[model samples]
Target chain A: MKKSFHLFYIFIVSISIVVLPSCTKQKGCTDNTATNYDSEAEEDDGSCTYNAETDVEIHFSSMVGTESLVYNQEYTINGRKVKFTRAQFYVSEIHLHQADGDLVHLEDKYLLVHGEEHAYSIGKVASEHYHGISFSVGLDSAANHSDPSTYAADHALSSLDPNYTHWNWNSGYVFIRLEGYVDTTAAANGDADFGFFYHVGFDEFKRDIDLDISQDLVGSTAEIGLEIDFAKFFLGVDMRTENSTHSMDNMMLAEKIADNADDAISAE
Target chain B: MLTMQFQLSKNINRLTNAGVIPAFVSFFLLLSSCGKDELISDTAYNLEIPKGFPAMDIPLDNQLTVQRVALGKKLFFDNILSRDSSVSCASCHLPEYGFSDPEQFSKGVEGRSGFRQSMTLTNVAYNTLFFWDGGATSLELQLLAPIENPGEMDMNMPELIERLSNNHEYPSLFREAYDREIDPFTITRALAAYERTLISGNSRYDKYMYHEKNDALTESEKRGLEVFNSSRTNCSQCHSGFNFTSFGFENNGLYEYFADSGRARVTTLHSDVGLFKIPTLRNIGVTAPYMHDGSLTTLEQVIEHYQAGGKLHENKSPLITGFQLTTQEKTDLLNFLNSLTDYEFISQTAE
Candidate 1:
């Protein structure tokens, strides 16, 4: 009877040792630097916040070197004059890399850049002292090759409303679209308006750009100026031989345009 | 065994704390005493998710119940839903033919032919669009189309309601399925619920790929899988994923010009003139007379069309760049396509 009682006591102790700690563990923000960090927390509750979120706006300044881009107006590039009709690109995965080695990712940071809707309202980010703001040129690979129609109507990748940036046949997005009439007739700058429609795509052609931009958010919203040189888009490229790429089959040409897209943006 | 005993003891302690064991026993006893005419319990139906299928997004308001699915199945097979009570949903969408018509275009109640071919309903729960033209966004909405169509059942809404209300079984069925009287919302909801249950994932390819059944596929079928997935062929560009369709519209170069504007009529986009929704390749062996217009009669002819590279067809997608296939490769690809036929799904007897 004595031996049996001791065995029962040992079994109860073992069970308590196994399960009691888990039951008693308090959950809260465990990060020490976070505003809501609890010193007594043993489990992370995902309520960690470094500071209050401040709204940030990113505005694009579309230009051709010294000349500002005007729709349907002529611009000289590589001694070839061209009239720009429509120019658009996607910017995504925007982040703020802090000096403290911590990173803050902007939620839903997909920006559709066009002449009309050039500015991107990069939603709220924690108001913390940061070294620089970094963002990518195109959508992340996760969002690539996915059915955009699956998303809600007002979603960034939705195929409804303001028209989709994706292709119907290839089941991929056109990362950048440049359409206009280029001077393809002459040796230098020509008079004839031979049309050019360049639609660049492919996940392999997706580029990332890290801009060393510093901003101090004293107010609720911060406006950051972004500039894209449309002239540099067709550098070291002849428009005469290869004008249109609606198919997105030319990998070599797509790579060139993708490389140029990295240098396309500047912190204005 | 020791842990199981300990768990049982812990559960007993919990039950003792709640003190509801007697109530639970009495509840079951009361349930057992009820007859068939009594109110059926509304326990959420256990929808079986096949190996390759994702969790379905069932609407919160219209939760699936055993009675609802049973009612839907009964309604689907019944001719009373038709105007003249001569045809049912099963007339066009035959189960033996993978829920598709054997004919090029399924005939209506008046024996008049339709424009497009009947699309296979295999794994249709995962579809983004409900129709070839994507006229209806949801399955619930699409159910009304066939019922109201002049060439289809031709039963108007008012007449349908009147007929359903008059039917002795329908009122009780609706009450059991939806806890309400006969209504349009309940009718559509029940139909959609039953249709979503028509899942098929037990194909030889699914067994081989998901269940790791190596012997499920033949050597020719294995080699054919390689050809189908090959970059040279580019078949997987559109006809990809577990469902064998990305559920997107594309102009696959069926003809130089289309007699019937498939998606273009719905969207009113000039560029979308010849485009139609890509049907699932599941049960492809049985579901033919193929394509939107059902122009191609056999799988061999469809393969030949892709092999020829849609050269004559102007609106063909640029991805349809022709590929050279040897006689062996062609046979292998066909074998792979045949491997998608789910025998278990076609022969299913249970609701």
Candidate 2:
């Protein structure tokens, strides 16, 4: 009877050791919304993985009045003929306003719009009825002053060949670059001979662009169309006297251009 | 059950007594100790801090390491950081010239002139603000300016990283130093680590002041020191402390019509216009053509500018109310400035 009791005690001890470890609970992704969520997981291990799909696509169209903006193509602005050789600007801090009043913030996302590049895919977001979209025309102070070399070569703020947006000497990013030829002559009859450049950047000059539009990402990708009119960018500036500003050199002109840039953007 | 447990314990005790289990445990401990010793030896780097100077505040993430300093020194002298491979940091900041260019404006890639004179790197580790306008807040950030400046290296940071990664030796060097691939974080940290090691404190002035060696300075130098500390000259007011700099931004009246707008470029304040960071007087003898613009060719000119109360700028320091110095006093003051040169620092090679 004693031998049988001892055997029973040993069996219980062995079973308890095996079962206790299992009862401690395994760690894994516990969030149901995550693509790699484990239903059996009792504790969240912060290993949640989500789908990297393009749920929202933002398209930009650069224009001068009713005409599509073409490089080196002459366009009339404020009764003067102007031709843009280059036009580029940065967009950052994108947030999508849902119909239910929840904001889907796309953290650390930056886009550099230049030339024929028009479409950008802001990766996977929760399926909802988005009512409006808001973004900054330039990088925030923290992003502007951050080391450009830290980013990957393919990133918008990379300081790579295609995106030489940083001012190394002054230590900040050039948010907007608009360079071209303008007819600064008194008669305004000759060809666009005067070279003009407005390289706008600074923490004070970052403009917020908000567009109220309906975009539903419930079934398919939500497409947001935006148009930027270049003519409206030169509303109050006289090319003859004010044709150049490197942002820091001419604060008044840079401020004027920044304000105009804000008014120029509209939701399509 | 009690008898069975006692028998099991006896068997374990026998194994321990027989030295089988004990030997295994001893071997494991020995292996771990050896690993720890090797790690300490490999990564430990002793920075020679000169006497009287306070211990430098090193970043926790980037502790001093021999491999990292070696990598930084190599990069500092390498022209590969430039766009055309025409210039290195040592090109403008020559070691012989006290890490300052003799030219008023240091030449960069394709011999393009920079706006301001190259500041001395001697004792730069102690500095909180960098550049004449104090644009950069840290040494790591300051390094990026020269590399990307169109007048300087003109090298795109991404391209430079790619180049370094592809190089035959840099990948291994970087791996050994940082235990990671060549990136901006490691590059900047390593460079800063090496720069911090450039300590210059064993000058004649240091011996006279810190060491209590009365004879270290000559009679003229001693009199010059008295003048420097005297309220009449007020030279020590801004150029105060052991490093001989308060590091405050002041318009020493270098110019009335400010071209660069000095600290105003960073602060955008009217009062900050024409104000530049006060440079250290250490190694001032060798680092000639002084001031932010390198307009003062000699120490005599600098003293004279101060004596004349500087060119009448609205934002000039009130301490610069002109003071007269006799001819003999001027010579003594000049001699005293020469005493700050650290010959041992400039000639020493990396161990």
Candidate 3:
């Protein structure tokens, strides 16, 4: 009788093991169209991602009057000898327009273009036929009000240096940086060349540019190169007269730079 | 599902002949059957958010628990968290003062003075940004500053972790709170959980605004509210949100020349010079010596500074242009500000 009881116990345990996992109703992505679709899924999982529909590589290539940006090299514009020692700015809130006029976007990404850093890989986006790219020159109000230290060390928001592009939560980001020494007629403090640092900040100074360039992103990654004309930075205003602007207090200079930021780029 | 439970019980009954005791198996079966899908932290105490307040943004990675909060409260009040065991988070931030220092500058270990005043932690859970200059973004990450600041606790994190690991009760408490060993992530998470619980919403102002209790404030306070909300005064322009601040940095026309760069120290933008975050005024009555550096002594002085305009600076907020105010208006405004104090909240302790 005891031997028969042991045999019954073995049968019961075998059935329990077979039936346990099936009882729990494991739900997962079943649709193959979904980016995270699970093939082995028995039930539909709510977690489905279609991020590939929005990913695209954006490139901002700095230039000076049809000349590719060569840092510290003198470029004569109008009548002033100018050379940018540091050229950096933020490109944020990239939007790609679909044929149906539906907007696909890359949200909360602040891509900083540092002259010294040789433009590292921005991001790998799923290739798709897209209309011209539209992006803001500076961080949006929401992204601007972030605490940098809260982000990872490698994050764009992390303050690399307090003296330059690593802006604070209060002041927002430096929308554009064109700092270099120029041949000045009058040396203010007995200096030969007058150094200029034009820094633009604040939400009021945000510039939006929508370029007209169509690209077929079938399978391979497509690069959206925006050539920023260095000469365009000094279009309306003379660099020799308005030598430096370091604050939003100078609304005139800030507005001038903001206007030039629109025509500063040509998409390809 | 019910049949699965019945089947599980039957299978456990059959396990008796395998030499396992029936009692232990039954207990295990019962525990597993009930709330097996629930998260581990769900078994702990739940957060009680006050009515009419925004939901607390707790990090998904660090959920609040009873053991975690209790452990954090103990750590916050305990001096042993400091370098020499002479100071703590509570040392500068007194409970009576709405978890802030009434002193102009908070003293650290060995009487080393901090550059900025200890801010009030009341309703801190609602803040998206932390500190006067907005250094740390999340509450979990905010603990690193004071613990490592030279003018603060000055406790090295590695040594602090070693000490906690070697402590008589910390290891066991950590294991209960977090099913892991003593580590920095667990430490900061516990502290953040406890800090998130410091909700102060039972004040007379909250009662009036949220509960529709108009009689909670006097006629003077009501008049003061009008003045505060008026565009001419522009007090609500920056301090407009539910928690009494947008938490954005503003120059506020503090000084012509700043010894402390404030936000400019981080952003390195000249436009950010002398800018400091707009602090919540929920418990402004208790948290005296206001502003980033605790420059202003009293509310009267602060209001007067606004009334007399302020020293002109490059990055000063344009809204800060001074307005004329009568003595009665000033008194009434002060009365309104005092109504923000939550009597019950100040008296309550973790115990």
Candidate 4:
């Protein structure tokens, strides 16, 4: 009897040990301990202050013109001086990768740069000094079909506006909107009205290009001044040789420029 | 004293042989009850495959089990998907009318009409593209459009995630649907998974094709297919294939001025002026009024418009060089289009 009682006691003890831990797991005991420990330490140390700020500036040439054939530039296209009317594009999801390996992610990533809408501007960073800025040249997939109602309310995230960008009930957005009639309808003559209309976005063909800039946002002010060259938008492609009625249907030139972001003359 | 001692000894022996007796039994029963509870909970969402339909394009990322589909169905029908609790996906796309609205445009959070017509959700899985302009290439992306659209559900991703996470029921459901963490992608994928099952391939026309049921088509329907494929119609060029869409946008000569630039608006090409995607004619009988703008109320009007070679011609489709079709052909073509209606699709349920 004595031996049997000893065995029973041992069995109960083993079961208790096993079942107790399971009970602790169900109660989420570990999570509570970890969080409490962290909070208590934080209270004692008075550290982890988010003291960081940075200014970002984006510059473009002509301040106008849609795709190619600069409208109102001092220089002439083929021979005739052209004047640009309007130019606008979307820049969104500004993510800053820091040297220390921390990321300073910006909210309201969408920024519309329209000559009429004033030079594009967005600022504020709470993380450590950033190393460099990485952003999409056009709208991200999620923001493309974003609801305008929510977008207007959350302007910090989405720069989409119906009146300005035309988030039609159908297509998400016109990534780059350049509108104005060409001077003449001839591909060969310099005097003909010719302009480029490149609405490059989520088609099956367009590639996603990551703009790599060797910028150091470390010590000083973590600000980045980006310059987009208007001159190189129209490269070897002869604008004067084209007529007004030509199709900007093919986006090979736009793709070339987007890919040629570095080669384009920078205007800061 | 001797008798009492013997009884006590007998009780001790029983207890020892039973291995802690009551306590052990209690523990085993507890474990068994837990297992039994799991079995009861495992009642499959009871998914019913539509007749004559192939296996759906179930997303690799979000597979549709019964529980997930049931959860998705509730969420789709629930007003909680909206920010202010004003709308659901079913608000715009109802289940009865082939998952399309009776009105041309649907009202949003603030009773505002969306700029475009509510698209039909029939056989949406077969769609290679979505929306009138084919903006979203996948069902995964299409879920975001209505949820985030101001004139639709009007919910942001963060707020949406918070709302779902906050709900006691949804968190558990999300945990079950995606064995991982809960986020926008999982939620969107689940919704997409439910929608992918909404195939409209069980229509009368489908029966005729797959089941060799000649009676599925009336004489008018047979004659209509003839006119539809004829040079005078040029309809089959775009509305071809089993799913009934070539996935090409054409300038149906809707307008000369560019208010709605259609594909041109997206591509910035002058040649694409007034061009819009050619929508599937499947279930056309129920999902009307029609067209991207929902301008045409009946199939007959749609046929007549095409018969008249459309209104504008600034950048009309090269294929639409005005074919001369008799009134009878137009009537016959409309009949064929009506036969494509899939009433059973509108009424399908996840059993």
Candidate 5:
């Protein structure tokens, strides 16, 4: 009977060694900071989920005076009626001023904003409050002269669709493309038959726009609203006489438009 | 040891039951087949550097390789680069005509004429800047312009990539040459690699000047060389050096009102208004219709234009002060220019 009892004890011990671990040690995400953290877990499963970093979405809207600007829509500017067929520009080298006085520079980032598209995510950043924002209207010299084909398909600098922003002959990106028809008639009553293109580009014509505004990005996402006023964009210029400028073709007009960009764009 | 054997047999039985064993064997066979298919032979290509010419400055990333040159030569002659596949680089730059088109302005897809004449690719590896306006900084970058220009190939980079990637033969060829898939980087580098091999320093002039061959040039041709180097003619002032071009942008007074605006289109400076990049005079006999506009049809017209001091323009080169040449001197100058043609360079078949 003692020998039988010893055998039973050995079997019990072997069973316990095999089965105790399965019952006692729970395998799950061991990180307490993770969203799916299991408090009862004693072993890590290498599966953990964490909160995403704060992302900033910059929204751009085109405006002609009071109403929102629409493509193929006519608007009166400088006492002349104009209708925009295409409106696009590149915004590059965005910088956000944090509340702690540290500037967050978004390196090698570019956004090819069009009249149709509204919002673009500038990617994730540290969660904090920002005081001001600064960005360039065009690409820097290095980015401007880089081979567009090297970029990914979805990249702003890629030579994909909506590629009219690049000047193939000149080997540079057109900073701002504002093409439309304007009424150049003497009485200003005729149809807007005159087509004008303001393709501002080249390194010298790149303009920097800085604005002081309050933005809190302490959450998962934050938004910044900006508007480009066409009425103010055509400020200090007579569209009837100055109907066209391909940057190098008419430097004076391109410079006027580039200089006027600071006042033309503002925080909404 | 018995337990280990049992465990091993059990694992093998499980694998066999799950059909993993056959799958593993087939996967290895597939991998071996792929290896055989992409057997890339990377043989180094020795570019024959012509005598009297400096060693070619090849990009570090794109060294000369036999497979790369062969692939580039095929691409050069292929018409698949265009939008409609109607024209190729060779269409505008024919190898027989010193890699230049006979037309005043080379036509593109659908017969669309370009603004400037197609420049010769003879010794194009020596060029510092590309295009009439010096728009492109490198030969690799220069190919992008012609490919994307609406008046040229009329094709974008993304589309070209798609087309090349879809081709059955190009992918393997590209893999063998560049060890990468077909992309802009490989395409541009390969084309440039072949063009850099177009060495043109085997002319009669080279024999006479560098090889010390006394009977290489005639007495009349010798006199023409004197006139060319003479300070009175100033021919060699802008068109200097072994390649016959200083590679500088100068307003040659081609126009008074400045229709095209030449180099100013790039620099945006008023002083650079009518300036265009000086072209190489090598193989001038075959690459005809001279000047950026291709307005002058013959060498005599070009010489006459220089003799007449070019058209009047404020930004004209100060060196454009005209010179006088006798009829015999004109023939000798013409003969000397013809001697620059390298029959071996142009007529040689692809290796």
Candidate 6:
């Protein structure tokens, strides 16, 4: 009787291990094709086809005719003139919002773009015909403070060039960098106005800008264009003569640039 | 009797032929039903909450319960999550020093050193954002960072799930904390739920702000509040609100060449070059060596740094140009900053 009891226990345990796993296995491996965890909770009726072709592009705009460039053209820096000739910034957290409010946010939302060009694109998004596109003008809250090495990726924008965006190091990416030559022809001071740059990131208060592309798109694919008005940047400030004396070392103009978020964008 | 015995034997043989024994099948069915029936509750697990704190903002997707918090606490302290099982979250952030590592920068797995100081978790529940740069908007999302960070715990998400799922206590704990399942999201949420309960609202500054208690703070501290609120100091412009931080990034005149562009790196803008997020002043006395870069050593030096309006001038904030403060005012401000410290937070234990 004792021998039979031992066999009985072993048999039951073994059967439980084998049969139970197979029973659960019938639910199948949750492939990457399944919608996000949030959708699964809603018991996604499979009505929304997970199979879709998607493409995304990030655009940049630079000053049109201003060749030599101007610094603090918008404000004074270190009691001198400043100009912004070069600028590169980041746009991240690209999320596709469905008509039902369900969102498909990409794991890697980091995109590095320069104003000298038009846009950059993340190829073949999951939902091409997204209801609306929501993205941050800068890094999202999570990635902003995370360690740089933790964000390692083979094809990440930071990986492409370490100097441009400061990747694989401590702190987050420089969301935007503006650089250019200062117009020093009319300067009263003999300060050289060449090689001026405006580097902005975590400081600027307007780090989080939400663009509602819902109105821009007609279907799954939409060309979300943002016309950066370079003229509006230097409205109240003068960079030409100021560049002779002022430079990046003087953060006053940088603060003005940091505070100058309202004057930066428009719908092209 | 012969007919009954023959029927029973025949039935048993029939079951055996179908790849199951009668008793084995019966036990498996019973156990499976019991496992399914042992569904975890969706509500947040119970953790001890101190008085004078607000209800934590836990994500709906990840509810906290007592068992889940326990599991999260264990995971939080477990060095097994590291690549070499050497360091854990608590390694840099100890419970004793208000969760901040004593070292300015922590040593990570494989004896690698981190770049920044380990921030304290005092009154972190009310934080508008996490990390010095405000990178993670939610706690749930923030939990994934340190675990996977190459300089930190250095563990992969898949391996973490596998290890936890195999543990005897975790399967049911996962089922209890999350309904009947174990996955990455559930684990992240549970851990986040546990962290959200860390509140530091009982500081002397909090009492003075809310009540008219005259003795809540010293006279020097009160004078410090005056200087901090005064225009000459201009501290309140960025450090405003009850949280004592505007939670926005600023240049703070830390560097000129932009070794770290700070928030500008995330936004990719030229104007944000030297800026960094404004860290909260709650428990400021204990959590420093100050600034995003940990450049200043003491509160006096920090105040002095601000008094001098910082070193870098190009694109420096207009608010940061020298305050020319009197020695008395400087002393007052430092006292006020020290008053923000809350000692009770580090003492609390998991109930």
Better of 4 and 6 by DockQ: 4
Give model 4's DockQ, 2 decimals. Answer: 0.07
lDDT against true structure, model 2: 0.82
Candidate 6 or 4, higher TM-score = 4
- Which residue runs of candidate 1 sit more than 4 Å off their true CA positions? A1-268, B1-40, B311-314, B349-351
How would you encode candidate 5's per-residue C-alpha lDDT over A1-268 as one tens digit per residue?
A: 7676545444443443343333334568998768899887776879887765588899888788887889878889888889988878889999999888888888777999877788988987777778988999998999998877667667898776464477766788999888899999988887787998899999998999999879788687888899888767689889989989988888999999889889988998
**Candidate 5 lDDT, B1-351, residue by residue in tens:** 334334433443444445544434533443455355343468989998778788888888788899898898888888899999999898989877898989999999999999788998989988878889998877887888888888889987778889998998899999889888887788888898888888888888889999999789888888889888889889899989999999899988777787888999988888998999898888899998998889999999999999988889999999997889999989988899888888887785544
lDDT of 6 by residue, A157-251 (tens): 43223334532222445555666655455543544356655555453323444444544233455466665655444455566533321213444
Best of the two (2, 6) by lDDT: 2
Per residue, candidate 2 scores C-alpha lDDT tens digits across B1-351 of 344334433443443445544534533443455354233444777998777887888877678899888888888888999999999888888776778888999999999998898999988888878899888877777888888788999887667889999889899988888877787777877788788888899999999988899899999999999999999999999999878899888998878798889888876788999999999988899998998889889999999988888888899998988899999999999999999999987665433
* Model 5 iRMS: 14.8
Candidate 4 CAPRI category: incorrect
Error at B99, model 5, angstroms: 1.5
Cα lDDT of candidate 3 equals 0.75
Tens-digit lDDT string for candidate 3 (A117-177): 4343445444567676788888887776554434543656654332235333233557788
- Across B1-351, the per-residue lDDT of candidate 3 in tens digits comes to 455556565666655555445535654565566445444543465887777777877877677888888988989988878898889898888888989999999999899998888899998878877888776667866776787677888876557878998899999898888777766677778888889888898889988998999999999998888888888789989887677888799998889999888887655578989999898888889899998889999988889888887889999999999997788888888898888898877775646
Better of 1 and 4 by DockQ: 4
Q: Please give fnat for model 6.
A: 0.06
Clashes of each: 0, 0, 4, 25, 0, 91
Q: How high is the CA lDDT of each candidate model? A: 0.75, 0.82, 0.75, 0.62, 0.83, 0.62
Q: Write the per-residue lDDT of candidate 4 for residues B7-119, one digit (tens) a residue.
A: 43444455555666655665555456545424334344444555554566665555667766767777788888887899888988888778889898898898878767788
Q: Could you give the DockQ of candidate 5? A: 0.19
lDDT of 1 by residue, A127-204 (tens): 656667777776776676554534554566654425356643344577888889888875854663888887877677
TM-score of 4: 0.57
Whole-model alpha-carbon lDDT for candidate 4? 0.62
User: Cα miss at B65, model 2 (Å)?
Assistant: 1.9
User: Looking at model 5, how many pairs of residues clash?
Assistant: 0
RMSD for each of the candidates: 14.3, 7.5, 9.5, 12.9, 10.1, 13.8
* Tens digits of lDDT, candidate 4, A103-184: 5567776676654443455565543544456666566666665533234333633322422453333446555554443445
Name the best candidate (by TM-score).
2
Q: Rank candidates by TM-score, best first.
A: 2, 5, 3, 4, 6, 1
Which structure is stronger by DockQ: 1 or 6?
6
